[model samples]
Target chain A: MVQAYILIQTEVGKASTVADIIGKIPGVMQAEDVTGPYDVIVRAQADTVDALGRLVVAKVQQVEGITRTLTCPVVHL
Target chain B: MVQAYILIQTEVGKASTVADIIGKIPGVMQAEDVTGPYDVIVRAQADTVDALGRLVVAKVQQVEGITRTLTCPVVHL
Candidate 1:
């Protein structure tokens, strides 16, 4: 299983709505509105890194109000 | 309480050691070795944003082997 944390920056005043929509996307475990450099934090999982990338780019990024996304994949060492 | 996720980048081959050391820090809730852009992912908490900043700059960043850190504070909407 591949898990990642997606840091998102949204348009001003759009954080809450963006997060709400992201939370319902398949593979997204949780999406929460947040304050700071990032406006939303997301936890998502997929079967592989490639699939994870697709989820972020094809699904998460397609959401309105999102400006940027930085996906940090969880790794075990 | 101010909670944040700290995405960390470390020198090559230092991810495990960095995570180990960071896990012992007082304010750090958890630290794990991870691959991709970040070498380690940390969860930490403080009483205020300023205190959180101090925890990152003074404590988390002080550890050797860390190259970069991006703090993403959690916000409730």
Candidate 2:
């Protein structure tokens, strides 16, 4: 399984709504509004790296209010 | 309780070790090595926001090999 943390920046005053919408996405395990450089932090999982990339580009990015996303894929290392 | 995500950058080749040490901290719920701009991603909690900040500075950032840390505190709205 592939897991990643998606750090997101949203339009002004949109963090809560964006987090709420993202939390319901199929692969999202947790999505919460946060205060810092990024407005929302999301934990998600997929079957493979490619699928995880697609999930970020297709599903997560398409949500309204989102301005940017930084994906960090977990590694066993 | 106050929760936050600490995005960490570690010295080259130190990601795994940093994550290992951080995962053992008392307030840390999860710490994992990841591939991206940041080297490790950690989820932690404390009794208050101030306590969370102290946890990040006094504990998480003190770990050897860690270069930088950005704390994103979870917010209800």
Candidate 3:
């Protein structure tokens, strides 16, 4: 399985909403509002790298109120 | 408890080693090497925000291979 951490920046005052919505997405393992450069941080997993990419672009990004996202895929090495 | 995700950048070819070292630090729940802007992504917790800050600065950052760190503290809302 391919797992990743998705650092997200959301519109002002929308962090919690974004997290709540994202936490319910199929591949999302965890999503929480956070304080710092990114407003929310998400943990997700998929069967392959391509599927992981699609999850970010097709689902997570589609969520309203998100301004930006940085996907960091976990590496075994 | 104060929980946070710590995004880290490491020196060239140091990603795995950095992840190994960080995974052993107290309060660090998970640490893994990753591909993208950051080399390592860590999940950690502490008694308070100040303690979490200190853990990152005094412990996580002190590791030789780490170049930078961004701490995002989880919030209720």
Candidate 4:
């Protein structure tokens, strides 16, 4: 399995809602509101890197109020 | 506890060593090598936000080969 951490930036006052919505997505393992440069932090997994990219672009990014996302894939090395 | 996910960047070919060193820090819950924009990802906690700042600046950043760090603190909201 390929796993990743997605750092998200959301519109002001939308962090909680964004996180709540993202937590329900199939590939998402966990999503929570966070402070600092990002508003939401998510852990997700897919079978391949391409699948992960599609999950981020198609599902996660489509959510309303999201401004940006940075996906970091977990690596054994 | 004030918990955070710290995204780390390291010199070329240094992700594993950086993660290994960070994982041994007292406040660090976990640290692992990761691909994409960031080379390492870390989970850490402290009693207060200030202490968290100190932990990152004083300990995590002190590790050899680390180039940059972006600290995202977990929030209840």
Candidate 5:
């Protein structure tokens, strides 16, 4: 499986809600509300890199209040 | 006392704008807008953990359009 760390930004005061919602999505193992440069941190997985990209674009990014996201794929090296 | 990677998210199409604004903040070493889970990533530091927190909360967070941030302090292990 391909694994990635998805960093998310939400509208101010909307982080906790966004994290909670993302945590329920399939393939998303965990989504936490955090304070710093990014509001939500998510760990997710898919069958391949392309699948991961699809999930990010098709599912995660579709969530409202999620202004932006960065997908850092885990590299074995 | 600390150095960190700040991952940021902004309203769609706001990534470049956010990065530009944050790059000018004091103590911000670098701010780059990238495609992924984080729209903008920043490297910064302060004398102590508290100062780092203060910089994040008082300064970085004050930037308009910055919805959330996550401070990943580099750890020596």
Candidate 6:
């Protein structure tokens, strides 16, 4: 499985809503709202890196109020 | 002196509130709500790395409904 952390930025007052919507997505293990530059942090897994990328670019990014996302795939040394 | 970004995730319907409160905390330079894997992203600084830790552990982490935090200190090469 490929695990990754995706950092999300939402609109001025839409963090929680965005997180809630994202948590219900497939492959998303956990989604939460927090304080910082990012409004939501998600830990997710997929069968391959390409799948993870597609998930981020297609599903996660389509949510309303989401402005930007940075995907950080877990790397094992 | 050190600079870092704190990624946070909170419970459902709590991202905006958490970010609002964290923005008022001392040393927090910026706090904004976002969508994706993390709910909030905060950029801040202190006189030292240890101080930054205290800020995160004592102040940022103290917010109610916050589930977890990941601190990423910016390293200069």
**First chain TM-score for all predictions:** 0.98, 0.97, 0.97, 0.98, 0.96, 0.96
iRMSD, model 6, in Å? 13.2
Task: Give RMSD (Å) of candidate 2 vs. truth.
Answer: 0.9
lDDT, residue A77, model 6? 29
Model 4 stretches astray by more than 4 angstroms: none
| lDDT over C-alpha atoms for residue B32 of model 6 | 68
Error of 2 at B39 (Å): 0.3
Question: Comparing to the true complex, what docking class would candidate 3 get?
Answer: high
lDDT of 3 at A38: 91
The lDDT per prediction is 0.90, 0.94, 0.94, 0.93, 0.85, 0.82
User: Candidate 2 or 5, higher lDDT?
Assistant: 2
lDDT of 6: 0.82
Lowest summed lDDT across 10 adjacent residues in model 1 chain A is found at A30-39
Separate DockQ for every predicted complex: 0.58, 0.95, 0.92, 0.81, 0.27, 0.05
Candidate 2 lDDT score relative to the true structure: 0.94
lDDT of 5 at B6: 88
How far is A21's C-alpha from truth in model 2 (Å)?
0.8
Docking quality category of candidate 1 according to DockQ thresholds: medium
Error of 3 at A22 (Å): 0.5
Candidate 3 lDDT tens digits, B1-77: 99999999999999998899999999999999889999999999999999999999999999998889999888996
lDDT of 6 at A45: 84
DockQ of predicted candidate 3: 0.92
Ordered from best to worst DockQ, the candidate numbers read: 2, 3, 4, 1, 5, 6
Candidate achieving the largest TM-score:
2
User: Residue A36 in candidate 1 has what lDDT?
Assistant: 62
* Candidate 5 lDDT tens digits, A1-77: 99999999776656667888899999999998765567789999999999999999999998888888999999998
Off by over 4 Å in 3: none
Which residue pairs collide in model 3, if any?
none
Task: Determine which window of 10 residues in candidate 3 chain A has minimal summed lDDT.
Answer: A32-41
Q: How does residue A35 of candidate 2 score in lDDT? A: 90
